[model samples]
Target: MARERLEIEAPEVAVHLDAQDPESLRRLVLEACQRASTVRTDHEPLVDLALSQLVRGTPDDNLARKLEELAERTDDRYLTAQEAADPNWATLFRSARLASALSLALREQTRSSVLNSIYEAAHASPDTAAFYRDLLL
Candidate 1:
């Protein structure tokens, strides 16, 4: 008789949150967002816009519409002309486009949790924490 070998795989670790303490969870999120903002600069402005909109309780549909309008306004011709006229136009346009996309994603509620939705749009994005930090400083 041949002996059979059994293969065992370790389960993936799940992040457990203490739902009872909303305040603590908020603090943790703020801290994480702040840290993430410092490291990730590519979409800082967009992240900031999304967080600010979320904090302000902006309606998803309204936010989406506004973002879409802004994105539409930043057409290829306008961007190309602006880039030609000013060297910083590229950076500004990139940030605008990113912000617009974030607004749409948030409106879609791609993630279940509010924080998760914002973070998914732009990981570790922080505008609220930064605002508080600036105010304190």
Candidate 2:
């Protein structure tokens, strides 16, 4: 009887990083952010599809229901945590939470377009436009 020895070799991997180059660093950061966003939404295919329809201003009952559920859950959690002590703080917190939820729901470009449309609508009303402009300034 004879015994033979088996050997395994690990594969080599290469990563390039140019710390001093601003453009390279910017590209790296952008790629990382894009990957992170994709991974964040990859687990929910139905939600992503529904949200894509929403981005196009399409009405979806499923999406609406999901959003309603999300809002209810968020409100419940906020109350459970007892973070609604101060009126001002509660309003700010809820607004910020809603904005964060929107960010997660829509893609970057769609979010920008939606927000821009909202701004435009605000400006379309002469009375409110002036107030909006004042707030911005």
Candidate 3:
């Protein structure tokens, strides 16, 4: 057997590392935030599909009922976990408004608790960010 070594490059991180100007760095960071938002919603469709199945299911009789009961229990647990991970509307709206208002400040490299929260919420759900972004505009 021969030994082999491989090197992997993280293209995303490289974008930030290669930035030579403040504006470029800010653009890269904003792009990263948007990418994070998209990644967070990747699992949402699967969860939605599961919920739809539960809602559309029909029980033929006792055996079907039993199977559905088991499914419901599992689905309930999954939904509960998903809910826990999701940011509430209030937080999402506030964050989007603040982030939008402070867009220049973000570029200027200012950090605050509110900004941090907004970034967190935005990464949790891109749709929430877009909702409030449009609402604020």
TM-score each candidate. Answer: 0.37, 0.31, 0.23
- Taking the tens digit of each residue's C-alpha lDDT, what string does model 3 give over 82-103? 5778544433333333333223
lDDT of 1: 0.42
Candidate number of the best TM-score:
1
Find the candidate with the highest lDDT and give its number: 1
- RMSD after Cα superposition, model 3: 19.6
TM-score of decoy 2: 0.31
lDDT tens per residue, model 2, 15-132: 1221224344333323322222232221255435544553454444555455446545645655655664654444333432342333333323332333332332232233433523
Superposition error at 58 for model 1 (Å) = 6.1
lDDT of each: 0.42, 0.35, 0.35
Best of the two (1, 2) by lDDT:
1
Q: In model 2, how large is the Cα lDDT of residue 27? A: 33
TM-score, structure 3 vs. true: 0.23
Higher-ranked by TM-score: 2 or 3: 2
